[model samples]
Target: MRKLWPVILVLLIAVGLAVVLFPNGHKSLRAEKGPKPAQQSQSRAVAVEVAPAVTAVYQEDLRSVGSLMSDESVQIASEISGRIESFRFSEGQTVSAGDELVKLDDALARAELVDAQARFELARANLERARTLSKSGHVTERAQDEAKAAFETARAAVELANVRLAKHVIKAPFDGIVGLRNASVGAYVSIGTPIVNLEKIDVLKIDFKLPEAALTQIFPGQSVTVEVDAIPGRTFEAEIYAINPMVDVNGRALHVRARMANPDLILRPGLFARVTVKGRETRNVVMVPESAIVPRAGESVVYTIQGGKAVETKVTLGRRSAGMVQILSGLEPNTTVVVAGQLKLSNGSEVEIVQTQSPSALEKS
Candidate 1:
């Protein structure tokens, strides 16, 4: 009876263990069979902004910074020394060619001219009398020759006096605007004294330099665009009228000069200018927004939507202008490209175009 008591005690312990482990085994089986909570699916399509690669006329231009200059600029200086009797032009006045600007005291010059004229007349009368006497053999040939020589000398002296009198008046060399007067009336001025500055501002000259390699693209009569910092947001059209034949030895650059019409005289010399020389026109070029380009591993790339997925494409680049880039190759006309949201994209990325921008809008970006 004691051994049977031990067997009963062992049986009770086994049952207790079974009771404790049954629920855990059932829970594990249910967990394995239960439909796993559907994995949270990732959003498939990436929202992106797109723009079309369009065909447009693209111009290759040479750009440079330079300065504005007058078509003709000169410092007005006195040619002869004298006291200014009167000023015919006011400061900052416009004058025509040959218009008198200053008048010096001509009293002495006038008197000298009168004396020369009187002497010339006396010499002429004497020469006539000497010729008449010589024809009748009343005067010797040598005496007649002396009289002729004296008359000729007096005539030359009279012409010299006239030139001296004209020098007393200073005239404008060309039609131009005069700067502020440097001398006042009654102020004595020496030769080469600065009177004023004269500038022909009806047309302005733009001087700039470009690399000597660009010489083949530049020529006379080519169109140029000029922008001034003083007058922002306005571009002036000009033409290349002159190009320096020799390249600057120090800079290895070719100097170029362009001309722009300024009938209103708004543009002045010495202003800073930005110049663009239009070189060649390429028609039907594939152009894309600058934002579309992604430089990777030393190559430029853009994403184009193909089969509703982003297809990474490698593109050859050309001239860039105004927030736009010229795609020399690797893109077709009218192809749509992702301009925005490129950071989240990969090859064959599903794209949902949230917005489409116009070609002109892309250009202005």
Candidate 2:
């Protein structure tokens, strides 16, 4: 038992020494083996496409859809009911102001006018005779007064007859192109019956609605560019001629009207149009490709390559146009930004730029 005690004491001392000196010894040895090869390989450069931010002349423009109209449009109609005697103008013909378009039956109107003229002449003679008799005091004052009143009434009747006769002829109110004639020769048309449609297409009008927030940027005489689907690849320049004072409550938009010259008369009314209202031009603004922007949570960010590593940067954005975005802040001109392969990127990540493209070229892509 004494010998066993000595041996046990020795074993206890050795075990305490091992526990104190080798605590976590196996874990320490495993850690010394280093990280996995896969983890080490992940540190290698990630292939990405890069582009430099550029300074450009950025013209802030408001875009909206609208429709085209004529400078002058009206539905030609008759003011008086009558049977059409003849049509002086053909369908779709260009007519000038005061050109006779339709002539209604004037036989009854002319007969009435003739009768009125005869009565008017007789009244004029009687009035002259009455004036002479009144001057000589041969007729009573009451008789002269009655003759004057009768003469005035007859003169008014003649004027009324002339008006009725003029109603038989319908003339072009303005120089315009007439649409298909609705009334033909000998067709009876009542008052307000549509005869045809007249549209002055030499100058075209465009109407568009924009959000009320853009009201400060738009005004009369501001120039705008109009693109029509009917006329592909062609853009027309127009000047804003009028703006509605009231805003549409339903849409919160302002109504605007612009005029463009259509000397060739190729543009017709009711065509769909895309309107772009040009605002102030900002010079030396930093612009980046839209692909470079990474929206994170509620903020926008861009990955820029600095010192061979990707540095995530928070950016303030401005107006976006044509697949490019204006960077209001957080980016400098000529700074290279990662445009592609940003999904595999993080802060301080090594990046290998496989392609470097111009901002404009990136926009096209």
Candidate 3:
């Protein structure tokens, strides 16, 4: 039994050694007779066309909110107190300057004019007869003088009547579109009561209030661009017509006006608009690709190619458009910036420029 026990122990030890060393032996055997090579991992670098960084001249653009308004907006009111006899122009109708719009009962005016004309004619005849008598010494000089004064008075009355008769016909002050009529035919109207609203829309005035700091760039006759949210993809061009000389003390803003031609009359008054003022065109500024500007925290950063390695650089940026941004400071012209393949980069990280392109790499040439 003792001899069998030693043999059993020996067998158990051999089994344990085989189990512990089997995997390692198998690995060594495979190494001696190498297995097939593993496939390479796919690269993340995205292939993109690139160009050297260059300076770009940009026109400084000022953005602000504005509204479309009529060049001349006014509420037409009745000048004389009387009932509206008839309307020559209807609501939403276009009228020309001096075109009759409303007619008031001018029967009295007409009668007054007729009576004044007859009086003038009678006075003229009397004066003629008196002059002839005076010339022949048939009438006294005082009588001739009185006849002359009567003729002048009669003529003055006729002129005054004609002036009042003209007021009975209300004419458009300027070429414009008529709004809703407040008074209808046979409706009594008092002096200074609104009859209709008239607005000249051939040229629209865009009014906007902007920060007073922008006043430096605002001037009369400067070119401006306007956009309305309601009309997307459409932009209107205008010229700055005027800028208020004073700024509002409460809002700290200045009023600016731009004139836009509305030949088709597409723009209407009271429509909201977004305005862009083209200030002085800035020249000789460095431009970098938008991708190169990396936003970190509240600031933006970029990687510059320095000493053949990636270097962290903080940049001051301005006006981003067309996939590019203007460098206000912190970067010089001719500086090489890594636009693509900058995600995996760190300061002084070793990078191999794979012309084949690997998106995972942080350095881009």
Candidate 2 lDDT tens digits, 39-82: 76665889999999988898889889899888898888889999
- How many steric clashes does model 2 contain? 0
Rate residue 187 of model 2 by lDDT: 92
Off-target runs (Cα >4 Å) in candidate 1 are 1-52, 213-218, 233-235, 277-279, 304-312, 334-337, 344-364
lDDT of each: 0.91, 0.91, 0.82
- Please give, for residues 244-310, the per-residue lDDT of candidate 1 as tens digits: 9889999999999999999988899999999988878889988999999999899999999999899
Minimum summed lDDT over a 10-residue window in model 3 is located at 356-365
Using lDDT as the measure, name the better of candidate 2 and candidate 3.
2
What is the lDDT, from 0 to 100, of the residue 110 in candidate 1?
95
1-365 per-residue lDDT for model 3 (tens digits): 98799999999999899988785887788887874444221232222222345666677778889789899988988788888999998799999999999999999999999999999999999999999999899999999999999999999999999999999988999999999988778999988999899999999998898888887888898888899888899999999988888899999999988899999998898898998888777787777778788788899888776555777888888887666788888888777677777777777744445442222232232
Off by over 4 Å in 3: 1-52, 111-157, 294-300, 340-344, 352-365
Clashes of 1: 0
> Model 1 — which ten-residue stretch has the worst lDDT?
35-44
Clashing pairs in 2: none
Order the candidates by TM-score, highest first — what do you get? Answer: 2, 1, 3
* True lDDT of residue 346, candidate 2: 93
RMSD in angstroms between candidate 2 and the native structure over all alpha carbons: 8.5
